[model samples]
Target: MQRQHSFDQTELGTLYLVPTPIGNLQDMTFRAVDTLKKVDLIAAEDTRNTQKLLNHFEVETKQISFHEHNTAQRIPQLVEKLLNGDSIAQVSDAGMPSISDPGKELVAACIEHDIPVVPLPGANAGLTALIASGLEPQPFYFYGFLGRKPSFQKQELTALANHQETLIFYESPHRIAKTLVNMIEIFGPQREAVLARELTKKHEEFLRGTLVELQEWATVDNVRGEFVMMVAGNDVEEVDESLVDLSPIEEVVHLIEAGESTNNAIKRVAKRRQINRQDLYKEFHEI
Candidate 1:
């Protein structure tokens, strides 16, 4: 089926959002190469990182750095180039761009300026993990990157725990173990989950079990490489808000009166509420 949009007469340069491999170079799509080769410029999250892939496929396209740190500054420059009739392509470090990654601002700006943006279907770690996860896919949520800083991370985890859809999260190799422990605490020890690591790579492993079991396994083994976490939807029995043993506000007051520091108390309450600690702290103190 042909796309409804008319591409033949549109003057605005086409912006191709290409998805590269999460792992395994052979996963690169043929159309992605053709698009990269045809575009005037390629906006890469990392030039050095993208160079390896470019060399392998022998794509001679010029690449410029466009990432989270510099996307604000780069958007206008890229827009200007696009306005000048230069077709541009955006690729992330891996998977697709604007997927818990930069490229959103650039895409939005292009759309605002009436630039034509085209998305090329390709590999994505979130969907890759989801399909193989054995979890219900239609009703699901993708929460990417539970980075360091335990307080905020736990808050995000807790919110997802209350969600009815299957939850997927991206976690770093170093933090996966700690994150799994946090998952066990927030979602319960019995939540069935899958941890996919080094997907499509030589040592790829998909560890599936309850949160407690996975935590124990990760603790003993040497875990290295990126991870895609798939956790089953919360059991209806688990989400009865009335069953919450303690109201967050009430818990906050109790902890404060028990001599817990304000910061500690707020962190505890926010986790229970599944809200951001900073937001909770401000509301609690009316800051």
Candidate 2:
């Protein structure tokens, strides 16, 4: 039997996942600029937005729109270009492509066709905020964007309230106020939280404190720009050692059988009972 290697840049089409500036144009990496200049074509989530970036860089790479609306139709043509020896770079409006932004479908398609996909890491609002947030970075979850409706947002927050890992989410200026209020209600007013706005821009600000304090500050007028919210996880409540030893596994299974998700069940039992979900998870898997 013979072994086959994956697509190479010289043999197959190269798909570059290029990250753009989150706010400040200067944040664009030197390598990213070089990649854009060298690629045969650029696929942008928003051509207009990307045009401004290209203009700033003076990199004459041609760009075409490849966002959620047109990704399905655009995949074939992009793959064809790659097959024809053209290297294409994918860029979202801001930050990295496919980081809860766009570009997953194209990347998946490229993988199926054995195309060479290379990612050039750069500015990421979520990670940038998380680092500045002073929150635990390792055990954190990224909830890209919350639902706009109050009800949906509330349900989502409530479901995640008891999460043991730090939570990160993105929000627009228009809805930041409402989102903060919902956070206070669901995650408790005292939960540690951080909100970073206008990252890398002149008005960039990192607001840190309890949910209540953040909400209070956000109420002021003109508090606006791209925002990344980092929230502290629920503290384990002390359990009465005398209580019946209801194994966390049993509780998880019970709740799941009653229609709760593994996630929901874990959070519910873990927060209310002060049990480590991971410990129970290990036991469950071992058995």
Candidate 3:
């Protein structure tokens, strides 16, 4: 086990994981701004976007591009600088550096090389939306983004169907309607959910209702802005043991009877049982 004492003085320069504003510029912490000004170099997800932020804060620190695409090429160079005692600060375009964003790879590299990595807490869209969601907050699971494809997305939802903790997900505007539809199918229509959008901005709004209602709103309303979707967990205490005895085909048939399409039902059953989806499809069709 390795322990990190962020403030301990060492020959290597510290790597600060600074969080920028999610939407409102006022959300920028004083420490984050100070770190950006003080660090020898700023590694940013997007230099152009970060330059605007730096200009806003009157910080003249030089920035180097450190995004998903350039991580492989930049980590070694950043690590080398850190070893030479040139302090570095990493920031994403908004929010925390590595939560469904770039910076995890560089952080891992720093840890492997025994570099001190300090984190400055600030705005996060998921936690910001969760407190006002009117759902259980303490025991929560943060699944940032679901798969985009229907088959893969439904399979993901199926795995999370039995979770007993609040579930948080990030979704873009274009796919929110489809995601809600899939949630309705797997988690059921009656499950409580909240959708928060344009968080911390002037046009921020929260829609709270059952999954069915959210699905309806998403379908008809002009769904714009990124979304933080918080879903109430499965509260059912009793398990249906009868399902265990059903054959693969029977399980698929059961899901189909419950409103899922045959292809989706087959996929879910195949995923849950750790069997090949194509083989299950073939066997079901043969019978």
Candidate 4:
């Protein structure tokens, strides 16, 4: 229950989450540029990439590397600087800072320490693709990136199979074909979907069709660039109980096949069936 007045004067400096352009440089907002220039320090996901954006905008702010690899080490230092009244702006390689990006940890630290976090609205690939997807826009779910592992990804898709809202997913070019294949298996071939690529760039294109058509296109055409895949929601209700027929060990095996850890799968099965956890664990391990 914390309230933040972004512009209010305080001893601690405000952390500004600035969004950069996803593709075209023109999409970089004026406020984002200004905040980048005005902040005492810039925590960037990639300093070299950010330097290019800074050069384009004629902004000469000093930047420090603050990516996924360095988050554990950087968060404390950044928070300390904020406490010392040095305003900081956090930016990712593209789009919003914390949307499937690296700024959320820093944002959490700032909030925990009573520092202000000011966010600037700017380009986002998910929403950018959603509006033009020719699907239901209002009740859409944004699922940024799917798990790389086949089983984990299948599990995730299986979990979302019954969602009535439209679903959004980010996928790399190399894996689009495989992802679509998995989606077809879980969401069916007839589900309407749109694949947006090279968003806001000169070669941007949108392919709208059913899951099977998209898979065919992926197989036949040259699939390049990052993709934003918007899938139409499930219209027909599916039977929710997928694990009802399986024995306790078989249920655990199913979850394990879907990439869940064995111990966790056993615990989940035990809790759901109101069985003794120790007995399930012993039985699972054949002990």
Best by lDDT: 3
In candidate 2, residue 5 scores what lDDT? 48
Q: Return the clash pairs for model 4, or none.
A: none
Clashes of each: 0, 0, 0, 0
For candidate 2, report its TM-score.
Answer: 0.80
Query: Which candidate ranks first by TM-score, i.e. highest?
Result: 3
TM-score of each: 0.80, 0.80, 0.83, 0.82
The digit string of per-residue lDDT tens for model 4 on 14-59 reads 8999988999999988888898889999999999999999999999
lDDT of each: 0.85, 0.86, 0.92, 0.91
lDDT of 2 by residue, 1-287 (tens): 32234343266768999999999999999999999999999999999999999999999999988989887789999999998889999999999899888889998888887777888989999998888889888799988999999999999998998798999999988889999999988887767899999898898899898788889888986776878999998775656464347677776787798899877877777656544556666676674
Misplaced by over 4 Å in model 4 are 237-287
| Residue range 1-287, candidate 3, lDDT tens digits | 99998898899999999999989999998999999999999999999999999999999999999999988999999999999999999999889989999999999999999999999999999999999999999799999999989999999999999999999999999999999999988987767899999999999999998888899999999889999999998874453587889998998999899899999988777656646678999999995
Model 1 misplaced regions, further than 4 Å: 1-6, 238-287
Task: lDDT for model 3, please.
Answer: 0.92
- Tell me the tens digit of each residue's lDDT in model 1 across 167-248: 9898888888899999988887767799998888998888888788899988999888889999998753323354367666
Compute the lDDT for candidate 1: 0.85
| Runs of candidate 2 exceeding 4 Å displacement | 1-10, 241-287
